[model samples]
Target: MPVNTDPKLIAGNSNIPLADAIAKRMSMHRGQAVKPIDTRVERFNDGEIFVEVFENVRGEDMFIIQSTSNPANDNLMELLIMTDALRRSSAQRITAVIPYFGYARQDRRTKARTPISAKLVANLIAEAGVERVLTMDLHAAQIQGFFDLPVDNLYASPIFALDILHHFQDMEDVMVVSPDVGGVARARELAQRIKAPLSIVDKRREKAGEVAEMTVIGNVTGKRCIIVDDICDTAGTLCKAAEVLMDAGATEVHSYITHGVLSGPAVDRITNSVMKSLVITDSIEPTAAVQQCKNIRIVPTAPMFAQAILNIAGGMSVSSLFDNETLEPIYESLYPNS
Candidate 1:
């Protein structure tokens, strides 16, 4: 059953800008100077975390928005402590709204003996008293099975579809491409939505830290390609794929990735890659380097999330927001200001 009460939005340091954007959409965010809830999450000199909720949350439905992105351990602990605090304070319900779920790529164990870190993260969140979780585009769809609580796995395909249509109205020579064989389904859906052909990059991963060699699976010659993937960790796969496609006579190569974990030499690699642009969502906040790169663009995700939260509070079906093959009408309904 959906809770009809207005939910309280609490934020952590993981992605302050994203959190503020979500709150602002709900008309709950006051400028930095004044806020309804005073969240005090601090760390000791030795790197220990402590959290305290100053405002009274007794019997309130609290929604904590925190992305378990880079610095995963620290941000995760902060969420745990804050959940504990809210539970101890007798909050009616606690929902952990994690945008970019870290450790999600470690969902399975391929080696003889290894830890399934994604399952462990699910355990930690459940153990912390989180009643529900709302996350976007998990690396592996099976990660949802690890969670005991109700999980709403939102798709970023709708977001990407709208942006692609707005920029590339003439789709005659456009092709949607998967960076690697693993992401064919994701890329296929976007291609189908935009009425474009689909292509795959067959990659050979020799070893860690080595750029993969790829071969195009479909005809991309003379076509403007849109490479799609769930994540862009170091940008090696995308950069290499872009070069391969362009070398094969591709006119332009653009990318749409959900979680931009632009770590290490990602920004530098993307800057030098043959890709025309790299569009990412605000699931994970962009770094200064990512911001400065002319090829990197961030699509605001607050309005999308804000509408999802509103639907949840009103007992409306949230999936209805983007449950169709065509997504232009959905985006317009949710973000008319755009």
Candidate 2:
């Protein structure tokens, strides 16, 4: 079937700048048929949320852009209520475009009685009247299986890979490092794109909040190591990995993560760590903590996501966007000096 034209965009309060940029990329001016469903998201004295979509959406094809980031529950419920509102208003379809999917790390239960919160979130979205989902760089890939509806799990590696090649083009010795065994596949995929070697950090979890980096699995002694991962929450794993790599004789330690959900003292940890730079995408809105950190840098993912939204609306293959040979050139143009 052909992709439908005249797709309607509906945005939540999570990241309006990103939503606006995506709308712009789709060749739509800021205020057109596509505009934010004007409403106020508030809470009562008892701490419950209230949302109301002001505009009419009857028989429209709606795409809701929201990031389940900080105050994840609120942003999540906002999406749910927005979907239900659209459904009740007779919107033909509702697509939830969540750039930074929160609760994704809890895709599986490691303990005896723990809950798989990611699956539960998926159920919540489905039950909330979402017809499909569009997200990027989930913490766990298997979470896609949790969604019964059509799920488009996009990648940020192409964006990161191009950035690295442009910034470190002259540097001959380069290696992509995975902070833990779990991230080896993602790191390896990026490494293959840049023709760089791959290294793994062997980490031992002493407790819930602490990590001890043991050894480097691959040769990274003389190379500039770039640690790659999906998210940097507390920066515990990244800081530990950078220290371990530096101690292992690596020349430099850099990091590129998709979602910079830098909570708590993550920015402080990165600022005080051995890493020379920590590059991340704007999948999650940058908080004041990120703005205050000198070591943190943001790579705009607006174009990639914008193109994805356009393709999806036009009934084109969204996956083919990453397969382009011009990816490096396009991304490098965005960050010339890197």
C-alpha lDDT of candidate 2 relative to the true structure: 0.84
* TM-scores for every candidate against the unseen true structure: 0.93, 0.93
lDDT of each: 0.85, 0.84
What TM-score number comes out for model 2?
0.93
Enumerate clash totals for all models, in the order shown. 0, 1
Candidate 1: tens digits of C-alpha lDDT, residues 88-153:
998888889999999998899877798999999999999999998989999898998999888888
- Lowest summed lDDT window (length 10), candidate 2: 27-36
Q: Show the colliding residue pairs in model 1.
A: none
Best by lDDT: 1
Off by over 4 Å in 2: 1-3, 28-34, 326-338
Candidate 1: segments with Cα more than 4 A from true spot: 28-36, 209-212, 324-338
